[model samples]
Target chain A: MLVIGELINGMYQNVGKAIKTKDKSIIQKLAKDQTKAGASMLDVNTGPASAQPKDAIKWLVETIQEVVDTPLALDSTKADVIEEGLKLVKGKAMINSTSADDDKLNTLIPMAKKYNAQLIGLAMDKKGIPRDRNQRSELALKIVSACMEQGFPLEDLYIDPVVLPVNVAQAQGVEVLESIREFKLLSDPSPKTVVGLSNVSQGTKNRSLINRTFLIMAVGYGLTGAIVDPLDKELMDGLITAELLLNKNIYCDSYLDAYKKK
Target chain B: MAVDLLKEKWQNKVGTITIGATKAEGGTRASTVTVGGQSTLPFMFGEGDMPNKPVIAMEIFDIIPEEWPATLKEPFKDVMNDPAKWAKKCVDEHKAELICIKLQGTHFDFGNRSDADAAAAVNAVLEAVSVPLIILGTGDEEKDNKVLAKVSEVSKGQKCLIGDATDKNYKTLAASCLADGHSIIAESPIDINIAKQVNILISDMGLPQERIAINPTIGALGYGMEYAYSIMERARLAALNGDKMLSMPFVCFVGQEAWRAKEAKGPQSEHEDWGPESTRGPLWEFMTATCMLQAGGDILIMRHPKAVEETRKYIANLMK
Candidate 1:
């Protein structure tokens, strides 16, 4: 299970407050707890909470790395924030996004290459997120081709087919999973497939259960990882179960250790 | 000739797995049995040499199993109460090339037995049967670890095959097997991708490639066997076509799956077209085992002695 801890993002009120106040302790604590909790990568996002997202993102990346060795998934909508975070990161990190759109790819891919960072390419183009598998698959192939043209290793490119909320768009999850399956068939040395997992459970009553179930089903269709809160036990349990079912964890030997720690 | 191509170009060589170490090696078994090391598909003599034929293992229980059909129950009626005696019957009468002793007692619903009980059962069965042994856990994660860990320790240096390691429980079992120098059966639920992933995980833990057997769970005839067959075929093709990660020899649990299905155990009166339970049960196992062998199964774990006899005959005929 490749956990991309969601705690450092500016969406949460405390994290938002920390970004505004420039409280290094809050950033440091979130990073420390998430890393200690076994997050393979911590997501550092500074959205509208920061008047200067580029500066805030740089601060989070630097502070987090000071305490932990786990890699960062530099999450941002603004190119500047992503660029600043990528520049400050000491080692190879993951750029949380680029889209199938030529503009985003043109800007972000070069920065990713310059920083030697892995990238998450969302399955959306100039028209925005596709609602069907064929469109999603087309967008994925386009992004993958762009990455290839830019001389990126397929392994370094993660395809996110953009999971929509299940309550609002029931068919979207299945379509995305199908797209991922189709993408696996097309790409040699298939790029890792991931998703914004919380999108599937947004506004749902048992959000954790919904997210985890969808994750397992997605994994069955060849999803390699996801951006999710590592602290959610149900989601963690589902990941462990999916890893076992997919035979990614051999005999579930990791579950015993996870269970004991939990 | 095609043989020249095999010698010069084929990359798919099934690793030879020798079970049970003699005193000269490290363990205390009278002899060892080797399987795998096939340079071509099963019985494809014209394509390449079949360095070793698939081997048969009789499945014996550590405790009297209540769920087994009457046909199986009748054969071991006398020694079902004793694990050692039961194993001896499987080895001596069945002429089993290997013995698979399932530790079912560890899974009782009335709580569970201590690890020592499992260890004792393993030791007794090992002593009773001179043929190489395969130890299977109870399928429960925590309980299996407790029992399998103990069995691994007691059977150390024997070079046994310990498993049914699913993704959930592979780490401890793989670690235990690694430490004990025993091989393992990496069982997956009939998906080629999963089979490859599990193989990668086990290999990542530093277990030698020769010490692992992939069990891409086979279904009995009339029980989605075609799907299992296709998955195994695909897995074999991938390995042969040079996917180094998936090139391990395969093991099939033919008996456990075959007899458990309704087609094998139902009364003849209920499904007259299916024939008698006694005949259908062993035949189901035999046919399933044979199909898997043709699909490149390196080891078959069978329940009934008749199934073993029938399967051995089929293998011999194919080889001839």
Candidate 2:
């Protein structure tokens, strides 16, 4: 699974202060810790705290790269802010992300191609989060078609069936899992599927339990990636076990340790 | 419809390792033999990179064997009593890239030789042959811990690959190898999980993953070689698929296992249709080594000069 660490975003209090003060140590340590904890990529979002998300993006990318070579996911609702981080990242990065609205895709797809970046296409659009699996799959189809028409490689596109917090939207949990399975049938190779994993457990009492249970179900539905807290040992262990049971990783007694080291 | 084949974007590559150090690197080997750094399964060059070719390590003993097959014993018969001369002959005559010296004499039943005796034999081989050495201890777990530790101390800085470090007994040798700058051969009894766990345990003891090689204890061609091969194949796939704990290179005992089989040892005098022992024995060893190399074995510790020569030719052919 492509685990993108969600802990480095500016929304986190430590990261917000670090961004404001230009604290390289905090960001660098977070980058190292996340990668060590089995994140294949780190999501770098200059959250609402940053007065200037654009400049903060560049700082985060440069600061993280100084310590580790794990790839960064340049995240922002603003295409221009993501573009700024794209300029500094050493290799192909993931633009996290754009919803299935034409206005966003019209700008981001070409920009993603211009910078040679992978893209995460959220299934919901400007209309808002879909309430059912069929609507989610329809929006996901729109995103896939847009990428296909724009000549962006399908495999380079990650399709996120945006999950709402399960407390109020219990049915949407099943909706998201079904959408992940449907997304794998989008094309011959299929679009990679991811989830904003923490959203499943938002405002929940047992956040880790909910997040990992949802992740394992999503994995069963052929989910390929997740934006998650790699530092959560139980969550990461659950992901490793899910991958093992799915036969994606060969079974071994120390697979949990092996996954982290990988 | 015209179709395109799918290929994997391998997320990780096996770590490269070099055995033996030159004069400048703090040891006195003529040249070092490097292995690992493969990003694909053996011979799948187009899918990924294979930085180094698989190399062979000729096996020698610290003591002469009591029971010997006439065909298998021909090459080293003269130097059976001498470790130094035996290693020299392996390097000079068989084009051995590495010399694996087994401390068979240190076993309590074999000879009960002291650690000092083992260290002397290791040093003598180091002095005789400039090729990298692979020092292995007898299977007696407790005694090997003491003997290998002392030999590792005496041969410090040579960067030889010494081991047989198992799940239960590894601390003494792992520390000595770390202190002496040598790689270890972690052995597991045909179980991939135990194989990975051994590496994790050794790495936890402060030896870097690169300083370890896996020995997924192999069987001869007819005697359960498939189990070993599948385990190695799974490990290689896991390694390339980003399993760092299982990513180390493999060291297989091809000649030892092959020679023990009746198919490789049975002479025509014993069985008329079994073929001449001369050709059948070496071919058995060669085929065994070939399968192991295909399964991603890095250092092949083999016996039988003809078989070793054939395997060397096979390796060159596979490289091209």
Best model per TM-score: 2
> How many clashes show up per model?
14, 0
Predict model 2's lDDT versus the native. 0.90
Kept native contacts, fraction for each prediction: 0.00, 0.75
For each candidate, the DockQ is: 0.02, 0.67
Among the numbered candidates, top DockQ falls to 2
Candidate 1 C-alpha lDDT tens digits along B181-287: 99998878887767766776787788887898998998888888889988877766655655555678888999988998888888888898887898888888988
Clash tally for model 2: 0
Structure candidate 2, residue pairs in collision: none
What are the per-residue Cα lDDT tens digits for candidate 2 across A1-262?
8999998888989999999999999999999999999899999999987899998999999999999999889989998899889999997899999998999999999988998988999988878889888888899889889988999998799999998998989888888888898888878679999999999889989998999899988888888999999999998898889889988876666678766666
TM-score of each: 0.55, 0.96
TM-score of chain B of each: 0.94, 0.98
Model 2 Cα lDDT, one tens digit per residue, B66-147: 6658888887889999999999999888889999999999998788999999999999999999999999998888889899
